[model samples]
Target: CGIFRLVVPCGAGKTISALRYALQTAERYEKRRIFYIAPYNSILEQNADEIARYIGDDSAVLRHHSNIVFKQDDGEKETKYKLLTENWLQSPVIATSAVQFLDTLFASKTSAVRRMQALGNAIIIVDEIQALPIKVLKLFNAAMNFLSSFCNTSILLCSATQPLLDELNDYRICPPRDIIQDVDRYNEAFRRVEIVDCIRGNGFSSDEAADFIFGLAQKVKSMLAIVNTKATARRIAERILKLSCGDSEYKVFHLSTNMCPAHRSTVIREMRRYLSDEKSSKKIICVSTTLIEAGVDLSFEHVVRSLTGLDSIVQSAGRCNRNRETICGTLSLIYINDEKIGKLDHIKEAQEITREILYHIHMNADRYPGGALSKAAMDEFYSKYYRSLKREMAFPLKDDPEHTIIDLLTNSPVGSERKQTAGGILLKQAFREAGEAFEVIDNTGKHSVIVEYNDDARKHIHILLSSHFIYEQKKQLRYLQQYTVQLPTYTIEKIGAGIVQENEIGVMILSNEFYDKVYGIDDELKI
Candidate 1:
């Protein structure tokens, strides 16, 4: 394998360089298609926009993710539609999420099966490769191997803190060099950051954190605090607003996935405008989720990060002092023990390994002899991390009886005997399975009904009722109007009681007593 790594720090033009490599490879091999996979939809959209700008054609690039608005020219009018119904491989340049890409490898859906044929004889760039799901690492590695060896594809594993993918016992894919030859060069180029390791027990509390942020806003030009969860971010923002003086004129912003992409983009644009305008002294403070960890190239003078995995900590550090100016900026890593660090077992184990290494290095200064964390320290960190979790690194679902059950439900071959025999039962079983509950808001401002499922059926009913049907349905007889549902204002008061279930149609909500009390709806209603 002639695969190689391109290790560049934040704001080092890695995305553009990767795209350049892909384009060169395509021209050299005369490849027709190129696949660029990212960890998030915003990133996918961002990269697609940049690629399209460089490539000089929007038609050459295709953005396939949730929230993508596609316009179809059917001659009746330019209709805004969705890309989910479109063929994924039809475009020469495809931008998608890692989940969508990997799901295609394991499942046999129309999108999954159809994209497989286009994967061959193409150049695939896996951006932020370290963010690859731990449970799917083995499956991903196997898939990469099969694609590189059998399928005519070239992969560029791009990231700052690159994981030890080849060291795993079941590893299959291998790259030529550690893509990043000189880590110090990147450090020198981006010399804007001065990492401040805040001592534990002295760190800011919820209220203190708010005060500190407000003080910083008054002093510094711009700032950002990247926390762990949405709820924490919201709490911090609320505290800041409460403590602020009258007419203080501070522009505070809260950003998280809880808001839609359109909303998030609007916030990001406002932040950028504030940063770029020198005349406007409107102090800006943004409290965000881990979504800003990678690919988002927003530069700030100071950043406060709650203690997380080492890779995440490093990425957060990258955002601060990003410009590498003469004045080295400070980044405070506050030790947050309250955060519930679940999911991604590999990252949790990596954090422990990093802590132990840091402790040992700090205790025996003469042995390591480095005042600051060195590149060798990071290398050793990842090496130890891979060695410790190699056995459990592969897909956790493999050989699990439940996966077989899920496969039967989701990927039973079309018209197969088992699928036909158990499909309906499996579909019903899926509905019975509980899912994450959501407050399904409709347009009429009325608490009409609640359903156990939030799938296509529920969506259709919500849309229809919100549309012109509400007035017509109201005119109908009271008994016939029972089926017409609407979302109410009080429904917003309910926080966490509905269990979202999945059916063949889509995601459904399992209504509970709490929902009944919140919406004041009859429990005997069919919903």
Candidate 2:
């Protein structure tokens, strides 16, 4: 029945330290279960592998993500994994995505709430806690408070750039006990990258940005550029490819959500091989979206990140010289003049706030003794960023603007007229309505399309279509998750039914003509 926070810098062994603490604390308190949750599947997979290696048995840890596929060759092992995922009851340690774990508390679906009982007296570790949506912060805080204070569960929040959750003016978490003493001192000591701000005058165009990145990659021999959109990443990658046409040593790679998970994984493995080969003079340049920023174990000599929130900048920097291969890697922050963040209001606001912070740092350089990546700098950035987003933190309902998700969950007058109480007050909660309004990721018009990227993907799709049993079909769908890419409904509609076949399970199977082996999903179809 404790709420705690672990605020250590990235690349400083935070994952292992948190795992060791959770295991010991769970053993001491006799906790029923241990849950390791992260914002991205990549993080969960990496940490789960590490945990399995540490414990000496892989089966001891249960993976509960949409993309996980147990060895289908071993029917017993596959059945064991499926049963464990059904209720999360058998596994002592469960590694899952943040969305799946959060749904247990917030979602109203029967399948989701059935696992809520598993959380009782559990040790829950949420990594990259700041990545949680801004609108859901109040609901998240309230839920965490209830879990720790009433349900006898222990909640551990871990992040390099922790948001000021307890200091919020509205619904907020109780003061969390810090696991590490002198977090700022530890962060300073573990600093591995130097921040270089490149958003001076008019920012670089698409071509200019590619040239800048190519020049740096030539010198460093390994570089990564993380941008805001897939189109921009592709544009930069294509430009870099043309720039290095004559040099067979330079390999330019493009990675984005447009590519399926399996494709991205293959690309990542190839990049790692090139990076680990010390004898080779190969130059590696990867241009990717923000998906690469979350806990991915790929290290580059230098990283170029588009200007966004301070937390994201730091996360991108984590991939640069992660093991401290050099004295200090450089993270160049650039602004792409041609980029358009249409309808991405949150990103736009964060960009503006970051620009202000950069201005402050430029004006008052003497005030920041530890440079831009310092703890003090992060504090200033989040304080202002959170202040700007104070209104949206409550997760307000669109239809009923007066009431919020917290109001609906706690005390909404849903059945007031139908069932009047003695005091004429309706104490009944609108659980269904609240769940309908709550979304971990905004998927308003988003549609998942399963692509036949390789033999493995096509095999899963065949199983998905041919299977008669509901359970087998469900398992096949989960297997297909790695072969799927999400596109907007309008984009799919524009591509027409000729290119996509909508299945009975409400997913589209992309035609081979629209799917590319290298770029993925064909950029020509992009709206």
Candidate 3:
């Protein structure tokens, strides 16, 4: 099996080139499956559709993410029912997430580990591989090493800015060829963007950001402002609406993960149509979260980005000057100080590292003007960043010691020469005790139901319901629509209780009581 690493910038045809490589691999090796793993479901959905269209074969494609599988089905619910009635691995081209693939390597259940067989003799293209959990870096690399060495599989590390996966101690798997040999050559060929570091005092405030956007909207045909969070995006969009007098003249759009995939797709399609139309002024202004950082191909003459991770900043830059048609447009990286920004664990660390790098670049711009923000600079940033976070990165899943426990449980018998047997048993017992805290819901409902609640629970329940691509919830059912609900555990102790019931429709429960009581419903009802 062959390996490669592609470090092309965004909108540089990475996806298509990777797809072509995968096809070539399949044809050359006579492989049956091609696994395309992405960081997000939105990207998986987009790529799967495009592949299906190009291949001209619906049967060859399989989309296997939690969000996309259970999304609100279009009018073709019946057709979808017939299509997804079987296991996902049977398809020739499968799209999934890195978590799903890695889960199989450390799976405790038979169902979760079943996909391991399909991974053999396949072309695995990991898009945006840097988005992988830092803690699982060791485990992820080990799995890739095993697959590439023993299972007759080829791995493609694909990203705009590839992370330092190979730098890890005892890292396994190496690319056969450098996909983008000279990044500077590719950058020069595909460079259409100009970076503008806004002077600190001149940067836009919340109110001023809106005013500046409104001014741009009046001048340009379309503009996009990529902010750091959903709250800020919505607030900025609202401010722009208030400041602009002729609200009816121009269209203002707000995009974030707060909206479901179906909703976002509708918005994206509408925007594309408006931009493509010749007569329509459109004057579109879209404020979005980091969700639009990749896989979305939208071009704008002006892009204003809130300070964030360097990779994300580059991704935002990619959205601007996309076609290289714009001679000299500006991408403003504004300095925004919000305490809430630090709440994001990963982004917080990234921001700190980026700030330090910017400090150095500010002192010596002639040597590292924009180069400080390039992929090579990011490499240095993460190297130091990981060293500082080595302990955390080494054991991210400290809560789950089952893999170690299982190895000990199977390898060493009781009353044997293995001195660690007692320690392993203790760890296993602790894990088993902690596992009881999580309740597994049975989602075998007869009529599809929607769990509605406040935004937080709603998001979780939505992910669970859509986990296996089951999207037939009733929109007219209000009671079922608003409260967060989970599948009731099938254990005998949890059956036929007030908060937990076993009906034909599946295990139904009230999430509030379940969380508050801590005990199973049967015990709570007895109390």
Give the winner by lDDT: 2
On residues 252-311, what C-alpha lDDT tens digit does candidate 2 reach at each position? Answer: 789998999999989998988988988888888999999988688889989999988998
Per-residue lDDT over 331-364 for candidate 3, one digit per residue giving the tens place of the 0 to 100 score: 7777655425734677778777877777767776
Task: Specify the highest-TM-score model's number.
Answer: 2
Q: lDDT by residue for model 1 over 1-527, one digit each (tens)?
A: 24557777667788899999989989999877888899876678888899899999987777766544322234222121134224455678988887678756665455555667777888888898877755556657767888887877788888876776776665646654566677766766655666666646645666667667777767787778888765567667767767665445677778765443444666788887887787986777778878887878677778887766667777787777566422877777675454455554654676577667667667875554322334555667777877776544443233342442233334424324444587554343321111111011113454434342224324444443444544333322122222223434454344334534233322223353322211223222323
Off by over 4 Å in 1: 71-89, 202-204, 323-326, 342-350, 360-374, 398-527
Give the Cα error of residue 299 in candidate 2, in Å: 0.9
Clashes of each: 11, 0, 9
- A best-first ranking of the candidates according to their TM-score comes to 2, 3, 1
Indicate the TM-score of model 3: 0.74
List ranges where model 2 is wrong by over 4 Å: 70-74, 398-403, 411-426, 467-471, 502-506, 523-527
lDDT of 1: 0.62
lDDT of each: 0.62, 0.84, 0.63
- TM-score per prediction, in order, is 0.73, 0.94, 0.74
Error of 1 at 378 (Å): 2.7
